[model samples]
Target: MRDVTIIGGGFSGTALAAHLLEQLPGGARLRLLNAGAPLARGLAYGTQSPLHLLNVPAARMAWHPERPTDFVDWLRAQGRPAAEKSFVPRSWYGEYLGARLQEAVRRRPDVAWEHQVARITRLAPHAGGWTLFDAQGARAESQDVVLALGHFAPADPHPDLAALASPRYVRDPWEPDACAGLDRDAPVAIIGAGLTMLDLLVSLDHAGHRGPVLCLSRRGIAPLPHRDNELQPPAYDTPDDWLSGSDVRAWVRALRDAARQLQAPQDWRDLWVAMRARTPALWQRLPLPERRRFLRHLQVYWDVHRHRAAPSAMATVQRLQAEGRLRLQAGRLQGVQDAGAELALQWKPRGQDALQTLAVRRIFNCTGPSSRLSQDRSGLFPALAADGRLLPCPLGLGLLTDADYHLLDAQGRPQRGLRYVGPLLRAQHWEATAVPELRQHALHLARALARGHAPAD
Candidate 1:
């Protein structure tokens, strides 16, 4: 009997586990491990607030691609009517994930599936298999293992903010009760102006926070809102001569020109979806220098367009802006210091010669997940790197992996039985973050593991 273990109970981990159950032969056993994150929800879907909606439409979120409308069907079965194009509450999607996992377990009772709530710190090779050491001094073994650790925490770039150990400072927005103790009447400042920043804004509104909100980032641009209309495939082909250039500036111009041809920003969304479908191919064709240049200059602009916000949530942000309750600043954080109930912030605005200061009751780090594994304080990656079990991508975006999702060792050789499937694949595939991309990886990995393809070494 083959034994397998998956660490992390988030969307990637849970989907992989469910697919594995169906693919593995009888008598094989599997274990699913999770620690602090809610089962099947992870950080993205852990929010219970009604305002936190899935950025993608309901029809495309099925764990099984063969059943493309499974999520919408599930909603109807539960007496909740939902359309294929509707953006539903994230909490409801979390419920769908939980139900799918339960169904997978129910169908394969002979597999001896189990869920363990524990945090893993280290992994070691043992007798042609692997042993995991959890936080409580417990150990578990499996013939094969997959590390679906999802996204890592954001890096604290500022030295002063990183040194603080006060209640007024929140390093992670997903932490339990992050905004619970905040003073409603006192102003709050957020360190990033991205998707996470938007989520926090919705949360504050739900809690009835009436104080002014401050948003600071190197680029003060928030993500554009998704259009309510259905998006169609590209109507015309973007000629090779038009987009064959390697310069990022020219590429941006080409996209804007294509959007203008469609005659509406709403049509731009469809154009974006088509471009995203080919992003991996386009990214792979570029040289390493060009990729680096794009990351440094155009990544933020691409992000704001690619990953959009829900219409209702976008409306909330617009409302806040109209009332002058929200402010966006483009600058770099210079320092932060404690000042009684409030914290003082110093920043140097872009294209300016002077520093600015502000005091706020609380500050949140919403810079999104840090892509560099070397900067991760977590013990998992460090241990793997120390033992030559894993190698960092050349761009430092994530773990280096081959085309088959097998992680690379320190010497840059693919290590079988040690697989990965999540946003970390961004280093190789530029569009790996969203569910549509991740589900393909999960299905392919599951099929490979079922065929007894794991390497003994």
Candidate 2:
């Protein structure tokens, strides 16, 4: 059995592996399983689109927490000039991660970086560890398993879109040419109005597709841009006070009101930063019904405000809209009909009774990954969930994780050996999406593995 079996090779898993190889006992081995696209890059940063820039600036996008400039230094050495406060492309970040992996592998010859190159269908608990079975009848065991299973394919809103179930439709936005073959003049429909939509807008523009693009969702609220980030205040020095009650609606309203009253000459974004600081304590205290309220009412606003896109990306979208090449509307897409070479979207505007149709040559699902581990379509999560090795969060942000990234079992107890180190901590941490937050979790998990401590801390 290996010392660590990282379920995903994305940033969270790979970062933790790198940290463990350096901090943990040197003799221990690391085995990584990457069913995702590229090894080092996770879903967000895995795209090859040079137009898709990171939401966060370069100053804070380092791989190591202790060494914040580690990535910048590496980039400078490789001739990627440091443009202060600029949001670099996702591909550049991927390169940095890939380089870091190479360095880690070179330094530790015994550590195994096996690109499983196959799907992990099931995970079972053995005597003192776990066994991961590949789709090809291969099984591997490890003392610890980390579910850094980054972003799964987007959740389909039109479950009965049998027309979209064909090869003509693209579910995964990161896949190349997911929007292929549409004439520049032909109309197109996008499922969600988030960063993914912005990415598609840029991609289509670059591809000379000046066609009419339609973006639709429940709220149609787009991600806000980051402006004057330096003025934003920290979420909270002691944010645990917010998570004590089962009344989620009241809590969210109180927070939103508090954010609205910010008169300290702060960036509007700081309100979100403050809210994020206390999310772990707050989410843990929320009861199931309260969490449901959060999902139903607060999820859309939180997503748009928190997960803002790069300014350049937003500008491109705005430019297109001004030129009448794009249309953003809040609607409920009822179904999709096959139109031979194109798909017709049946939708109704938000709060309107009348139905409408938008015929487009293509459609892409960017509805974000499902927050529930139990509902995860990936073969790995369900297997672990069934075995009681992993559990879902009450708020359904992701798999249940403790402070140190331990996956919880069916009985609400932290699984002793296995641990996580990515945005997987979303169930516990609010600011866990960006690299700055992820690096901290990764570093801590590595220390726990090295010290051989239980995951509850």
Candidate 3:
């Protein structure tokens, strides 16, 4: 039996595997199953576009916290030295992760490590562990299973929009050749205004598409850009007393008050960073009603500020906007229809009484990952839910997991020997998506598994 079977090979899975290999006992066998993106370069970092850059600076992106400069050190050794504060292309980061995984494997030849490209569709409880089945009828038994399944593609925002399924309507912008075959000068519509939309803008520019690109979302607020010198961490006064409350409005008021007192406008970014360490606790403190209120009202604003883009990428967006090649608008997309030779998008502009139509040659859903598990088309999650092996969060954010990241079952019992670590932990920890937070999760989970705390029945 496999000592540990990891169900995804994205960053979270790869990082956990590397850590486990370093800590697991000799003679232990580990298996990594990926649905076919490269082992380390998952959807986020697998882009081939050189213009797609890491939002975080190089100094802070290392997978292992103990070796904070591991990424930078690797870059230097590759003869491609980058400043500690520079935002490097994401592909390079993917290469770095691949190298790290290989190093971990090479360093521990005593442990058996195997990676297979398989799409896991279901998991069955067997002999106190799990019997995992892939799409090909193959099966594997493990003493412990870790679900590091990364982000799923965005769900169709509107029911009507889903019905108009044509090649012109791109469901996932990350898919290869997503923008292929588009006329160079034809207008395009993107269904989001967040970091993913910004990435699409960069991609469009890289592809030499000079057509006007319209980005539409409910709020139409784009992500803020990072400061050029992000290396110097700013000072922000922490309001510990104010943060103890469970009221969302009170928390927002405190944040706004603190923002007003920032030494400089850029210091607001630092203020957000200062609040990062406390977000998960604050989120947990709130009653479910208050959490729902925050999601309904404040999530967009919080996302724009918390998840800022690289200055270079934002600069490209601004340049395109200034050139009349890009446009950002606040609106709700109502529906889509076939317009002769083009697709017509019907949307209601923010604060407008009347709907308007925009015809574009192509429309891409640049909206980020789907948060609702009910909309998950992947057979894996639905199967898990049906078997009472997994429980979806009450808020519909992600799966429910305990403090140690053990997945909770339908009856709210923590499933021993079964765990998860990824953005889905957002169900419990509001700020669990990024690399910094995920790396920590990976490390903690790895340490627990290595300690043999989760024994097979």
Candidate 4:
């Protein structure tokens, strides 16, 4: 029997397991190693709040690409709202993923589907396969291993304040009661204006928090909201025209010119969809220098536009802004200091040299995922790097991988029998994060493994 082990039981990992099992031989074994993260939920869908919604619509979130309407159909079968364009709660989606995985295991009783809850910290090549070692020295061997370790927690952006041992400071918002425990009457400073900040704002509002909220980020830009209007793909220039140059600035100009041609800004969303469809090719075609420049200078703006908020979530944020309860600022955090009854957040505005300060009762970091491997706290990634089994991709966004999703070694050669299917592939493919892109990768990788035909590197 071919034995396969998947690390991290998050969305990607769980989905990969289901798809792989469906295609594998009847007696193959599959092991799922989950490190504290809820099976099938992962970081994105683990939120308990019903206020948190999927960025994509219900019809587009199928775990398998071939079954495009599987999620929506499941929702309908359960008598939940199954509108094609509706944004559903993430918790519900998690349940759907879990149910799907259970169904897969149930159908293939002959295949040993072992689920283990442990943190694997070390990996070693053994007997033409691989061995995984957990914290307690427990070991498991498999013929193939897939690194589906989802998103990494954002490192403390302002490391100076990381040493503070006060309950008033929260470095990670995903922790239970992170924002809920804040003093309801006192203001709170959230260190990012992206999706995570929106989530915290919604959570605080639901908890009846009436205090002023400060949403701070380097760019002070918030994601645009999806509208109820139907989505129609936009027709931009021919591939020859858009792909003519590798200059980042030229590409941005072309995109802007295309959007300007349309009368309304909302129409730009169509162009965004088209751009996302082409990101893989566009990203690979650019030289490394141009890719780095895009990340350094244009990533924030691109993100705010590319990844939009659900209509309902955006409306709530807008309502909060109109009520004068939320303030968005552009600045870099300098440091934090103790004050008489609160903490003083020292920061510098976008263009000013002088340091400005804000006093708040509590602070939370919502700066989103950290892509740098050096910042990974888990001992697993560092071990891989030390063993020459992993290499950092360009722009430090994620690990280096070939087009076939095979993890590259220190010498830039694909490591056979070692695969990766997660957001970290963003380093090689700009559109690797969202469900639509990820599901395709999962299906392709699984089919390849089952057929014993590794994709060409």
Evaluated at residue 336, the lDDT of candidate 3 is 84
Taking all chains together, the TM-score of candidate 4 against the true structure is 0.95
Model 4, residue 341: what's the lDDT? Answer: 80
Task: Tell me the tens digit of each residue's lDDT in model 3 across 1-457.
Answer: 3399998888999999999999998889899999888889887999978878999999999999888889999999999999999999999999999999999999999889999999999988887688889898898889899999877879887776676665688888888788788888989999999998988888888888999888999998999998999874866667558566799898788888877877764578887888888888988898999999998999999999999999999999899989988889999998888876988889999999799998899899988988677765658988899889888988888998988888999999999888999998998898999999999999999999988833455
lDDT tens string, model 4, 220-240?
Answer: 999898777533444544455
Residue 191 error, candidate 4, Å: 0.6
Q: Each prediction's Cα lDDT score? A: 0.84, 0.75, 0.88, 0.85
Leading candidate by lDDT: 3
lDDT of 2 at 91: 92
RMSD of 1: 2.5
Mark the 10 consecutive residues where model 2 has the least summed lDDT. Answer: 229-238
lDDT of 2: 0.75
lDDT of 1 at 182: 79
TM-score of each: 0.94, 0.90, 0.96, 0.95
Best candidate (score: TM-score)? 3
Q: TM-score of the candidate numbered 2?
A: 0.90
lDDT by residue (86-194, candidate 1, tens digit) is 8889999999999999999999988989898988888887877888998887988888889887787887758888877645778888776888877777798899998
Error of 2 at 375 (Å): 5.5
